[model samples]
Target: MSKPAAVAQAAAPAAPAFDVARVRADFPILSRQIHGKPLVYLDSAASSQRPLPVLRAVEHYETALHANVHRGVHSLSQWATEAYEHAREIVRRFLNARSTREIVFVRGTTEAINLVANSWGRDRLSAGDEILITHLEHHANIVPWQMVCAATGARLRAAPVRPNGELDLEAFRALLHPRTRLVAVAHVSNALGTILPVQEIVRLAHARGVPVLLDGAQAIAHEAVDVQALDCDFYAFSGHKVYAPTGIGVLYGRESLLDAMPPWQGGGDMILSVGIDSSTYNELPWKFEAGTPNISGAVGLGAALEYVEALGRRAIGAHEHSLLEVATERLAALPRLRLVGTAPAKAAVISFTIDGVHPHDIGTILDSEGVAIRTGHHCAMPIMELYGLAATARASFACYNSLEDIDRLLEGLRKVRELFA
Candidate 1:
């Protein structure tokens, strides 16, 4: 779903300041214990846990309004249709899009990116054309463009990233030349939590006549996004990453661009009329949506967005920033521990490694202590190789996380270090 333009940036108003304890109460999973210890969940970058509101929303829709939408005239169908379409409006409002037509629902960010590659890339890209991405991109953002480029004989170029895990903007700008057709980048690095200079990236790409697509899976839960303000051609994100269920996501495209692009997949809901000779596709969003969509998932996603909005985006940002600061400092103070991705501006994620322990081992010990964290290349092997590492222990935060969570993480890390020692 889309957001209001007002809360899209770092400097948005922080009124009704975030209340962490109050917010934590809304998420029931936080109360669960692991290994006889209170659960310290810090894997939100992979998937955020759902709150009561989202869960209830999904349950309500499935229980009462479980019917196929847009084709039926019965009461149940009409109710289902309203819930689904209202979800579209929620997305449009969440992203500050001009209309609901620009918001196309897909399975998740991966599918959204693939949709653009298959539809837009296939239609517009040709031999010798170039698609530029960054070294810090998640594989979801990288592989689809690679497949599209390989199919079209278009070249793929990766913009350099600095030693500190920040994008080399100078190198990125230099790579945009006559042959560059698309510039795709992540708004927030999933591996490092580094927020990219997307506004500048958009401006530079547009100056070079290249359209931009932002992978915002890691950005949406932590901050507000306005498609118009960024002026990006497309923005994609996953519902699970933002506290909704899996198998639901959004792709926001400029109305003109989407209108001109052909449907990536053809099915019943996407066609206006089908004939033995020829077929006419449905309008903007449904044309892209294709089949019977994820009705309940959309309803849950709408409720999730509303939940975030009521909490205040600016306040959430501030709260998470504080957690990151504390977590970074405490982790840095640990003996023989190295922190990765120390960008000045970041979301609430920390990837690190202990001197004598494998990241997997670290994750294992942490889990034993009821401190859940992620460990791997994080689907960002390119960035991992760039850092000359195999993997890192990643602790990513959400609205439900707290300073005490970081404390448990640190305590768990100390155990890992002691074990290795």
Candidate 2:
């Protein structure tokens, strides 16, 4: 599809009969009151609220099967190991990966990226090599590469972002030079909600024998990610962004690449044997997943993915796009409120600023009216620098949100205007 067409399709709404009320009923927290008013949560991009199924799954694991995995032959240990490994299989299926060996569990997206940088980048990157990225990247994507580059005498280069928040495709293509060792980028910008052209990026990078890593923290919750179809070397995402518990995430690496990379951490379960003179590491993913794994968190993540699957990702995307469109049109019509990151193809995140009001003030005022939104640079300081912005107030949506929630947001923003005026 043409870029514009793709953008339009991304912004397009799904079926109108998406029973959002029914979906809202699944989440227990949506009914709570904040400051004597109904809570209007618009901060899913930071961390999504967990659904009942995810909570129940974690509770069940903790109550019935709490034990360390992969070592003990006891029943609880075996059960916990089964649950943990089963979660790995679910993640493998979610990403359409070849096997569970390609799925490595970590604390979250940050640790996953660090694993690749330390294990893969440090091993292969030499002096004068280049690591190419985009200005649309979150700090998690940029800092790891910068650290690796600084250590290896490699240079870090970032492609420019258009004023509309879209990545500069031509500049990105040009930046993929012969010495470009890796291409790391956000699948969707958390700050701008820009949906990057990752397929083309992967193709371009692979054409020049460079591997690509997609930070899927923002994209995974809203879309169906088939790593094989994208053909990217590495895909990382955090669980908290997807209605799962925090401190749990997955790294889907191509088996060949993962096999060649050394262990990123050393501890129990990651080692096959230990000797005073020399030690041997475990195979495939276990080599990278050192220490005791987050068993209950993995269970919760599996349940969360199952919940998303049951609701249908496409349906959720359409519902969110509708919210985005309505919010954009309404916010744009208001005086002195300017929308930032008006990318054509975007996830359901809206970042904006008022002419005279600081984003923190906006957030604080909105909070008084029981509306919760993120206000800050959103950990994308480079993107903020690119736009000459200190911060923007961001309202991000998820499946449980509804048109009523958007109305609440508008009402809260009006209160902000009234207070400022």
1-421 per-residue lDDT for model 1 (tens digits): 2222123233446533455677777788989999999999999999999888888899989998889999899999999999999999999999999999999999999999999999999989999999999999999999999999889999999998988888999999999989999999999999999999999999999998899999999999986799999999999999999889999999999999999999999888999999999899999899999889999999989999998887777778887888899899999999898989988879999999888899999999999999999999999999999999999999999988887888888889888878888
lDDT of each candidate versus the true structure: 0.91, 0.91
For model 1, where is the 10-residue window of minimal lDDT?
A: 1-10
What does candidate 2 score on TM?
0.96
Candidate 2, residues 114-170, lDDT tens digits: the string is 999999999899998999999978899999998999899999999999999999999
TM-scores for every predicted model:
0.96, 0.96
- Enumerate residue pairs that collide in model 2: 14-318
* Clash count, one per candidate: 7, 1
Compared with the true structure, model 1 gives a TM-score of: 0.96
